[model samples]
Target chain A: MTDTSATSAAAQAPSGVVDLLGLLAYAELVSFFRLSDAAGLAPDLAAKGELAGVAATEYRHYRMLHERLAAMGADPEAAMAPFVEPLDAWHGRTEPRTWLESLVKTYVGDGIAGDFYRTVAEHADAETAEAVRGAVSETERAEAVAVRVRTAVQEDPKLAGPLSLWARRLVGEALSQAQLVAAARPELAALVARGATGGDSGEGGSGGKGDLAAVSRLFAGLTEAHSARLEAMGLSG
Target chain B: MTDTSATSAAAQAPSGVVDLLGLLAYAELVSFFRLSDAAGLAPDLAAKGELAGVAATEYRHYRMLHERLAAMGADPEAAMAPFVEPLDAWHGRTEPRTWLESLVKTYVGDGIAGDFYRTVAEHADAETAEAVRGAVSETERAEAVAVRVRTAVQEDPKLAGPLSLWARRLVGEALSQAQLVAAARPELAALVARGATGGDSGEGGSGGKGDLAAVSRLFAGLTEAHSARLEAMGLSG
Candidate 1:
């Protein structure tokens, strides 16, 4: 509720956590919308059920985040408010045209977003970290999506090349939109950067706030994980 | 799994129950998609969350029906397959264009569907009736949707006329689709008819299979309830 016109004074303060939770909350909320809509592209009822089930989990994550924000005395709406446009824009740009495309998006998008959140989790306390893990869907859904995408790719080998390209597009659009989010809230960006490098609060790792090299390492890890996921799905990384 | 091309012999038999459960399952599944997608049209996060939460509930109901179908030795996917067209057609025709329109659709659509299912519930076994009640969402969701719609209508009296018209269209479309389904599967229709009239299996009430007079009464009750719902939402019933 502070007049955070600039993040200069408290770049990695508690408000940064609020902003992170807000962003994650809104992200999952929209994921619920986007994933469920994508279910329509499913060819069979079984696949449709799988996607819808995962989407329900996303809404569950959103509700958890919403509650967390309230427990922290942050306005859930306002926490999510700053995120609507960027998240919407990301979804707007990377809309899946086919069921395979939707599956790839689920696999790639959830994979990268989870890595990003896990990086941020280092800066958060234990409970918040667990909550972020719930939002990430790394363990269960990723495996389910992998099996689905892998089976689809095996059934139609032609899908792999195009799906890989589509996945790259998804990651590109996501990264660019993520930059917009980071720029709008420097404190959160700084906090995440410090967490990424395990930096002490007193000094920026590279003697600059949100050290570029540290952020580079963070995304490098995400990129590595993304490549592994792509390989698991029988798509080119 | 029987080749049920002719429903005459099996009218009011167990397959009729499968058909009903399948219809409900698919209805709720697609409802999950439609409602979550509609959440995007919400003006704010709270409204979006409310709609998405209800959509999640629908998915949970869908899962329950899916389990019930499997427990009954019916292939859940095969059971729901017959319903895809009519339900999809209904949604395709009645895609809501505005936030209020979506809310009105939710209210009217859920209200009528619940009543229709309740009429069927009477013929179902006790456990099945309870499950149907769970899927109906008559108590919690109706109140939630009403408050949301009423608040919107009070804020803009001009919306009342158009939204009321929209609700009527929803009911019309719903009834037409219901007839299509009944015509396709006479046993389910007959089962519903018998349930509507509280008749024993020995005789179709009024000396006809699925007595018209009883069906008339069933719909009269539905119409009356629909009007009361409309009135509660401050619309012309």
Candidate 2:
């Protein structure tokens, strides 16, 4: 744990918490909706039911974060409004045409997003970090997607090339959306910069150079995690 | 409750139970999916969340019925397979174009379907009756939809006309699909026919004329109940 004084100083800027939670809450809600939409494409009843079950879990997460925002006297809708466009755009740009593409998108897209949230949680207050962790903790469904995709690709080696290209497109679209979000929400960007500088080597230190370096490192971290996810699914990033 | 011997006679036909449970299971699952889809139309976050919560409840109902089917050694997929086409066609025919239309469909459509299931439950064996009753019992969400539609219509009386027509269309499409289902599933039709005769005047009587008369009474009962629902919604039949 960091020094108590340092934690208090960061906590003074609760807007950052609101920004993160708001973003995560909206993401969860949209993910729930999209997952249900994608469930329609499943080839069989079992797969459809499983995806619907996962979608329910996402709604639960959305509720938890939404309630937290309400408790803090924030309008959940107002807080989530900024995120609707960027996230919806990402979903629109990388629309999954088939059930396999849908599975890969969920696996790879959610994998990177969850990792980014966890990394950002480190710079947040304990409560915020814990909430973020809880919201993203349900990985069992992702494992199901991973196993199913891996098996499908194994059975048909031709699928790997198309799916790999799909994964790359998902990553590209996600990063573009992330850039839009960062450009629009400076508080969130500043928070990340602070998170990068205030930990370990330089406590409570930040600057433009530091922010740039931190963002680059964050991108590297997210990319590496995405590669690991792709590798796990027996595909190259 | 009817005579004990009469109940035992109906219990001999387990296929009817399987058919009922399978239809209810698939209905619950598809309702969950469609509700989530409709939630996207909600004007605000709270409404969206409420609809999503209702969708979750439907998922729980699906799980309950699905588990019971599995316990009874029925393949839920195969059992539900017959239903999918009819239900999908029903949803496709009466697709809601607006948020208010969606609410009316849920309020009126589900209201009638639930009533039918409950009516059918009377002929079901004790265990089957309880299960069907359980699956169709979550009416709190429907009540919410009713209140919302009623208030919206109260605020603007013009909605009453279109929504009333939409509700009628929903009922008409649902009945058409029900006819399709009855034509396709002989076991289900036999069960319904058996329900017709054994319920009222004759405790254990079965004849072609008697069965046809019973079906007429069943239709009348369903129509009457649907009229009551329309009245409750401040609309005409």
The most accurate candidate by TM-score is: 1
Error of 1 at B223 (Å): 1.9
What is the per-residue lDDT of model 1 for residues A1-237, given as tens digits with 9 covering 90 to 100? Answer: 333443332343344677777887788788888887587688899889878888888788788878766655557798789888998999999999998888888888777656557755776657667777766654345777788789988998998889999988887787788677666666666655555545544234433554454456545655667788888888886
Q: What would the per-residue lDDT of candidate 2 be over residues B1-237, giving only the tens digit for each residue?
A: 234444444346444667877787788788788876687688887677777877887787788777666655567787788899888888878777788988887787677657646645786557656766765777545776778888888999998998888888888887778766765665565555445444544233233334444445545655677788888778887
Runs of candidate 2 with Cα error greater than 4 angstroms are A1-15, A120-133, A190-211, B1-15, B116-135, B190-215
Please give the RMSD of candidate 1 to the true structure.
4.8
How many steric overlaps are in each model, in order? 0, 0
Candidate 1, what DockQ?
A: 0.74
lDDT of each residue in A1-237, candidate 2, tens digit only: 224444444446344667777777888888877777686788998778878788787788788778766655566777788988998898888888899999998888678657646655776557657766765677435877888889999999999999999999998888778777766665565565445344433233233344445555545555777888888898997
Question: Model 2, A187: alpha-carbon shift in Å?
Answer: 3.2
CA lDDT of each prediction against the hidden true structure: 0.74, 0.71
Error of 2 at A61 (Å): 1.0
